[model samples]
Target: MYTKLKDELLVEAYEHAVRSQLDGEFLQILKEELDRRGIIFDEAKKVATADNNKS
Candidate 1:
């Protein structure tokens, strides 16, 4: 349950970061944080796209 929540939050943060156009050191920091949490932003994006397609 906790893992699921964490994953959701990470995805949300990733989406926000992308929308915010974060770059350089700030973007690197976000990537490192996600990596530390074992979250792959690309996979999350793919999953999100697939889900949207399904709908």
Candidate 2:
């Protein structure tokens, strides 16, 4: 399902999840899928990780 999504939508979804501070599981799944597809969101990952640590 994730793979079927357009590249722009995938990145948009990831960015939204990070901005929304989604739960670890949700973010993890997205992150993993993105990584598997070789999509690098280094800054977003850093921000998401930092936010997760706050919870």
Candidate 3:
């Protein structure tokens, strides 16, 4: 349950960052932080796709 919540929050943060037009070193730092937390963008994409498919 905690893992699921973490993943959801990570996805939300990624979405917010992208929408805010973050780039360069800041974006890289964000990616690195997420990676360190075991949340890669590709995995997030897959999770999002799966969620969409369920609807």
Give the number of the best model, judged by lDDT: 2
Q: Rank all candidate structures by their TM-score, best first, as comma-separated numbers.
A: 2, 1, 3
Model 2 TM-score? 0.62
Better of 1 and 3 by TM-score: 1
lDDT of 3 by residue, 11-44 (tens): 6777788889887677677677666656544643
Top candidate, metric TM-score: 2
- The digit string of per-residue lDDT tens for model 2 on 1-55 reads 3658755577788889989999989998987877766665465453233334459
Worst 10 residues of 1 by lDDT: 43-52
Report the error of model 2 at residue 44, Å: 12
Colliding residue pairs in candidate 1: none
Candidate 2 global Cα RMSD: 10.4
lDDT of 1 by residue, 5-55 (tens): 455676676678888988767767766766666654454364233334457
**Candidate 3 lDDT score at position 44:** 36
Kindly report which residue stretches of model 2 are placed more than 4 angstroms away from their true locations once superposed.
1-3, 41-55
